[model samples]
Each structure stands twice: as structure tokens, then as C-alpha cells.
Target: MPDDDATPRAPRPALADAVHEIERHVAGGGWDGPVRVFALVRTAAALDADPGLADRLPAEAVAAARADAAHLTSVEQEGLPQASSLEDLLARLSWPQTVDGVALVVERVVLPSAAEAAMPADPEEALAYLMAHPDRQDVRIAVGVLRDGGSWCAVRARANDDDAAVAGGADLVPGLVAALATTLE
Candidate 1:
């Protein structure tokens, strides 16, 4: 006779596949603006995700990452950095070996310097100017990693015209793959 206490679990995604899915979601949403990313990792979980990474990380970094494992769980919605501050925060980060995966959030505008300079100073005029320029760009996207190294993302773009022009994920954010790689490394 079998016992009654059994629960089937959902299958987890492969780390790489999870990353790709996040990219796909962002692309589908036509995200275009600034991007912010965070990595959520566990040393053991990271090793399971990428065995090759075992050789690349320093012991200290791995220890630090493990110690910070609960960081993501404590983050509240208002606790996230403002979109404008994303770049500054990223510049200061140094990923450790215990990092299992990465998370990102972006809000950006892709406009030529000339266009920015040509905008009107008056609020009404600025609104008019923006309405007249269909090519003006603005996008926002958010990506996050699970403790197991799986990832997910959400995106929204301001204008459909500009949205159709940009690619998703790595193509959308420069240095993204490298930044993500740091965690695994």
C-alpha cells in the first residue's frame, strides 16, 4: 500500500532556456528604454546550472554571494532603484561566484542628440513636438532571476514605430550578457 502524502512538482526551466524566455518576453513587449539588472544566485545552484563555472570564481566571492542569498527576498516594490539611477548602481557592482542568475529592469529612450536639442522648452510645445515625432523612443523592461538560475522579464515600449526597430534582450542592452556572465563566472 502507498502512503497518501505525495505532491508532484512543476519542472524547472534550464538556466539558459529561462534567460532566452525572458529575452523573448522583453522583445515581444517592444521594450526600448533604460535597463536595470540584478542577479540572484546560490553557490550550489550556480554550480548545477553551469559546471564549467566552478573553475572561474574566487572562494571569497562565492562566500559573499551565498551570504547575500536572501537579498532578493527582502526587496519591496518601492525598494527598487529608480530607473534614472540604474546606471550608477550597476557601475558599482562586483558579482561573486555564488551568483546563480541575473535579473534586469530597464527604462530608456533612444533619441538622437539633435532631436533632444531641438525639443521645445515649453511644456505644451514639448508635448506637441513629441506628438509630431513618431520616431521618438521610450521603453521599460524588467528581468529577474530565480534562486535556481531561471529568469523572467516584462517590457513595455512607448511608440510602436520605434518598438519595431529595436531587437530584444542583449541586442537591446549593451553589456548585458557580460554582466550576466559575471554571476556565473
Candidate 2:
């Protein structure tokens, strides 16, 4: 796989253009379906990639992004690949740069947060995805009320069981619990 950083990230779009696109998407908001989160965030990231586009996004986009994460997941699974290169798509959505840490956080943390309205689901498998991936982050901050003693957790390589990555649980489950509490609270 190519280095995400080295990849020509979708042409460093001009800021004004980025903002305009974001605003445009915001105006057409209320796309409340699976993958909505991804769409909503894409707007901001596009702007981040080009700050000039900030004025483009409407206020409603934030609300949509906050409320509809399941849709974001769907969008990532179904839409991103069709639109651009995975790196470009990921950049467009402001996905965490570290694939491994990102995978783990999304699976172990973000997924559970999304399910807050319904049954509490387990994100262990999701974490496993990150653990299995090669490009994992060495340290991740788990802040707020859920933080493990109000601290960040370091996810380093432990020489044991390279294959079995804290299955059914987070590598730093204790910190995860703390982080979740903060996020939920």
C-alpha cells in the first residue's frame, strides 16, 4: 500500500473552493440516512484541506454530522471508493491519518458511541481491525470523563500474540471505558 501522507491528496484544493463546496452540501442537508456522518464530515474536511471553503458550509451541516453517524459508516463503506482513491477519500473526510489507530478507534470507540440510542454494542472486532492493520498509532488520547484516570493510552507493540489483538476488547480497555464515559456524559 502507498503511504497516505505521500499520496497526492486530491490536489490541495483552494480554500475558497473548499468552503463553497461545504456550504453547498450544507444547504442540501437533511440527508438522514446511513453514511450521513461521512458526508457531513467530508464537507468540513474539504474545507480543512482548503480553508477558503469554510464560508460555504451552512450551520445545519454540523447538526447532521452530530446526529447521523450510522449513515457515515454506510457512506464510507459504499461511497468513498466510488468517488476517489482511498487516500483521497479518507483525506476528504478527515479520517484519522493512522490507519491502525483509526481502525481501532472507529471500531472500539466511535461505533459504540453511535449505538448510544439503542443497545450497547461491542466494538472489539472493530479494534481488531486496527490492531491487524500495519499502520497503527503508537499513542491515542482518551480524554474527558471516560479517560482512564483522565489520561491518554499508548498502544505499542507487545511481542506476544501478534495475531490475537485484544479480541472482544480494547488493547486499553480500561482507558476506553473512561473515554467512553467522558464522551457519553
Candidate 3:
């Protein structure tokens, strides 16, 4: 059997665009924010279900949906219950059939691999250590996964905080991508 991790999945343009869109939207709010989740839905399907929605959605988005059947719209989820960790939040998530996919935006302070050995065991101390580390990097990661197994990720570093500087790929953040994929399952 082929190793799933080794398999390369073709990039889904619509999903990539949706992930990037969510990343940019979250970036607009600046850093030091709570985790945000979004439900991905096919714009055409959403419109067909309720044509009245067009009046509420952005005009450009609606027009794009009409022009391309693959266009996806990201609907931000609100009032999510607080979880001890992101993994716990993801573990508790399950999507409805209507949701084509899911995306999550989260900001994290990352240090170089060398810093891992020096991290404090206490959660609070670890956070403090990370914050005080001279090499620490603040990054916002947006990961999107479709039910069809397509996934995309967008990463924006605080050091190079520019929309055009954002890095994107299918496996940029593989662990997060897999976690998001399980929500669809």
C-alpha cells in the first residue's frame, strides 16, 4: 500500500484561494488574536439553496461564483467553545454535509528547532520562554482541507508581514492539514 504521507495530492485552486482569502482576512485584524474557524461552502450551492443570500454576500464574490462553479465562500464560525488546545478544538469538530470543507486561522510564536531542547516544562514558563527567545518568530497559519482530500496552507510571518510575501502550498503545515482533514471525516 502507498504511504498516505508520501502521496502528493493535486492542488485545488478554489481551495487554495479560499485558504489565502481566510489568511488575509485574519491578517487584517493584526496579531495576538484567538483562533478563528471558517466553514467552506461552494458559492453556487449556497446561492442555489437561498438566492436571497446574494444580497448579503459581497458582489464580487457572487459574481465570481456565477462565473466559476468551483468558487468557494468562507463563512466564519462564531461562539466556539474554548478548548485547552487547538488539537482538542479540532478533535471536537465535525462538519455537516453541506460544508464542502473547513479552515482554521491561528497565530503562534515559533522558535528554531534548537530552542526545543531548552523549553521549560511548565506551560506558563514555556510560553514565557518562547516570548523571550531572541529567535522566536510570530506567524499566522491558515489551513484549509476539503472533504475530497484536497488541502492548502498559507503562512504569514510577522517579520515579513506582507500579503504578497505569504507562503502557500499543499503541505506547508502538514500536521495542521491532517488535523483539519479529520474534521471532514
Candidate 4:
């Protein structure tokens, strides 16, 4: 029912609901949701590192988690984020950090109530939004994480941007994690 090109999206605020739903899906226990959840939590951490990101949204960790769900969609398993706009965040990210401003973006939104919430609203628009964020030097942290995770499209966008600052900065970040992505992903 989902597609690879489908944009990654933001998650919502249904922690309890999500937990319950996941519990049912894997009533037997020892499910592998952590890998996906950790990835998003990391993304939120990165957003919190940015100074300007917080004023735009609070509770970034939640947002980051949802973004993670959207991204996990690529795997084509059960449960993910529902929002479409969040793809902008997902299509562009790789990690979230607990240090610095990354927390702001991480904690902004709420998660979904069930596995169905993973459904996206508008994949194309979300993808474009994610692509657009790294167009400048200001979103370096965001770009860095996304590029590191496996989002080559974000890396290419930054590498090819008109702004030398963004292009140059993006160039350096990916290499830092180049070796890591291969073994990590």
C-alpha cells in the first residue's frame, strides 16, 4: 500500500495509543520497533540543537519520532506516521541529537493513535519540503543528519545548491559520516 518515493513525514502525539497499538501488533513481545524509534529520537535531538528551530515548534522529540515513522515507511512494514507535511522533515533528515538546539525540533508535535496513523497525507509535497530545507547554510544540522542516515537526495541537493555556503558545508558533513552510514544502515 506504500511506496519508496513516498515522502517521509512527521509523527503525532499519541504515545499511549501508539504503544497500545504496537503492543497488539507484536503481542508476543520483542518487536523491532526500537531501530525506527531511535532513528527519529536522534533526528529530534539534531533539531533541538538549532537555535531558531524551537520558536517554530515545541516538543521536538515527538515531532522527530513522527518523522521517524514517516521514514520507516520505506521499509513497508506495519505502523508509521500519518501526516504528509512531515515528509519535508523526513526526506531531509538522518539523525536527532540530545545536545544543543536539536531538542526543539524533536519535541514539537504529537504522534499517532494506531498503525494506520502511519499513512501519509501528501507524499510529493512533503518530499519537496524536505528537499527545500537544506537549500541554505542555516539548516546544516538538519542536512547533516539526513545525509548521514541514507538520504542521498538531501545530500545531492545541498551539494548542488546555488549558495556556496550550503553546498560547501553539505559536502563536508556527509564525508564525516560516509563510513558510518555503510555499516550503520
Candidate 5:
């Protein structure tokens, strides 16, 4: 006997898959340097692909995705920001809900002695020098975030022993994380 009154089930939320990908990425010390990662998703596509998410998603967000399909991009193909530029990069980006989530794997810059010597005392000049000398840097802290407002961070300091400290070290980039979170909002 067929159950005509029953509604069909929605697909799994696409966010689950994306979060899983993040988990896998960080599982094996894979993240080594500063990288700004974003998951630019089309709300329509996400819903079509994972209808289960509709129950939790707001109408406005879905509308925004439909309206801005042109701006949507796949993270798989586009890849993360591959440089160590720690400038106010987030200031330049303000994505709508249709754009999905963004994650950042950032590292505190440690300059080589020679490069540090060459850098000017002026902050502006130092920024310019660092921008031109990407080769002379090493990154240590890595943070990841999801559109649903979940966040994670990892650290690889020169001599880190306390797990609590490493976990708590996420506080080091609250401003950046806050900025990235707005993209999902």
C-alpha cells in the first residue's frame, strides 16, 4: 500500500558536507600558512542540492542567493587566498547571506632577521615591505568557520605544549573572525 499523505524527505544540509571537508583538512596538520578560505555558495543551488536546509534557512537569505547567483562561486575551483597578506583584507569583503560562509587560516607573521632589519620603523612602510616580501614569512595560527556560525582554530607555535593555550589562542584573531562571520550574516 502506498502512503500518499507522506511528504518526501529533503536532502542532507550542504553545510554538513562543507564542515566535514574542513574537519578533514585540519585533521592531519594540513594547514601550514596564512590562507583566507571562503565557501561562496548559491542559496538556490544549496537548497536544490540539500533541500533539508530549507527548514532552518530564512526566506530572505534564499531570496538573496537567487538574486545574486552571478556572484556565487565554488570553493573547490576558486581555492583559498593563498598569500600571507595580513592587511585589512576582510574590510574589503561584505558578502550577503546568499554568498554562504567564509573561513580564514591565518598565521602571525614571523619575519626573517634580515628582512626585519630592512623593514622601516613606520607601520605603513613596514606593511609595504611585508607585502613585497611574502617569501620571508611563516604563519602559525589557523582558524576555520562555517556559515551556521560555528568556528574552530588551531595553533602551531614554536614550542607549544599546553592544549588549553593552543585552543584558547583563537582569541588572538577575534577581530578577523568577527569580520569573517559577517559575510555569512
Candidate 6:
């Protein structure tokens, strides 16, 4: 039998595509951008509810929606209020029945497990330590979760900096996935 880790796992098609699209859109702006939030709605349902939307959306997207029942349309949420942290932003969010899911895109700097043991307790010192860590990686994670409990994630490292290098899976970032799921509930 093939090693499970070596075997590739496919994420839910609709959610995976939506998450990747959002990741690409965000990546276009380059790095060090603010957190972005998006509302995921079934494309067919949106078009059915508002036929005029078909005219405004891209022709390809409309056509894809007609071809696939599971296609999702991601609407970027703007004018979000400032929050103390990402968790606080998520905590203040609650999707309506019309929204089928939610997605978040955020950039973070991460250090190796070994470096955690030496992290400073003070917030400023911790920030300095992370910045000075030679092994740190800057990554942007896009996580999407549906009301039905399906989740998908896309991670792009600044070093790799290529769409082809972006990784995808259902549980790539479990904590972020769970946080996004709560917004749907």
C-alpha cells in the first residue's frame, strides 16, 4: 500500500477552488496586506435569487456556475471594523442564512518548533524574537468552511511565491478551519 502521507488527498472541489481563487486574488496585491474576509455563496443560488447578478459577474464564472451545481461565488467583505486580533474579528462575525460559507486570508510569520522554547513572554520582545529568527517563514493562509462542515485550506509561502507551489488540503490549518466554521454557525 502507498504511504498515506505520500498519497495526495483531494479537498472538496467547490470549496477548494473558491479558496484557491481567493488566495490568488489576495496574492496579486503582494505580501504584508491586511486580513481579508469573504462570504461564500452558491453561485447558482445567487444567480437564481438575483438574475441581474449574472450580468455583473464574469461570463466564465456564470458559465461555470451553470455547468457545476457545487460552484461557489466568493464575495469579498469590505469595511470590516478593526479588531484586537484575528480571533476577535472572527468572534464578532456571524453569517446569515443566505451565506453558505466563509473564507479568511491572512499573512503570518512562523518559527520552527525549536524556536518556540526560546520565545520571549513580553509581546514586544516576542515580536522582535520572531523577526530576528533566521528560520522564520512568511506565509499566507486561506481557509474556507461551509455550513455543512466541509473545509479547505490553501497555503502560500513568500519564499516559494508561486501559484503552483501553493498547497491545499482539508486540514492544513485546523485551528483556522475551526475558527472559520464557527462563523457559519
Which candidate number would show the highest TM-score if scored against the true structure?
6
Model 6 bad stretches (over 4 Å): 1-10
Clashing residue pairs, backbone N/CA/C < 3 A, model 5: none
Per-residue CA lDDT of model 5 for 29-144, tens digit only, reads: 54443354656475677778888866767676666556664223235324334433454565555556555555555556567787788889999999888878865544455544
Candidate 1 overall lDDT versus native: 0.47
Go through the candidates in order and give each one's C-alpha lDDT: 0.47, 0.29, 0.91, 0.29, 0.51, 0.90
Off by over 4 Å in 5: 1-34, 40-85, 96-100, 110-121, 124-139, 146-150, 158-172
Checking candidate 3 for backbone clashes, the offending pairs are: none
> How high is the lDDT of residue 172 in model 4?
35
Structural similarity to truth (TM-score) of each candidate: 0.39, 0.18, 0.92, 0.19, 0.41, 0.93
lDDT tens readout by residue for model 4, 7-66: 422222222223222223332232222212212223344444564644554465346444
TM-score of 5: 0.41
For candidate 6, which ten residues in a row score worst on lDDT? 1-10
Q: What TM-score does model 4 achieve against the real structure?
A: 0.19
* Tens digits of lDDT, candidate 2, 74-152: 1222343443432333344333331111111221212233333343246685556545554443322111111112212
Cα lDDT of model 6 by residue, 45-136, tens digit: 99999999999999999998999978999999999978999999999999899999899999999988999889999999999999999999
Instruction: Estimate candidate 5's alpha-carbon lDDT, on a 0 to 1 scale.
Output: 0.51
Candidate 1 accuracy as TM-score: 0.39
CA lDDT of 83 in candidate 2? Answer: 33
Better of 4 and 6 by lDDT: 6
Task: State the lDDT at 11 in candidate 5.
Answer: 16
Alpha-carbon error at 9 in model 6, in Å? 12
lDDT of 1 by residue, 83-138 (tens): 34555555555445554456665665555678878899998998788767757767
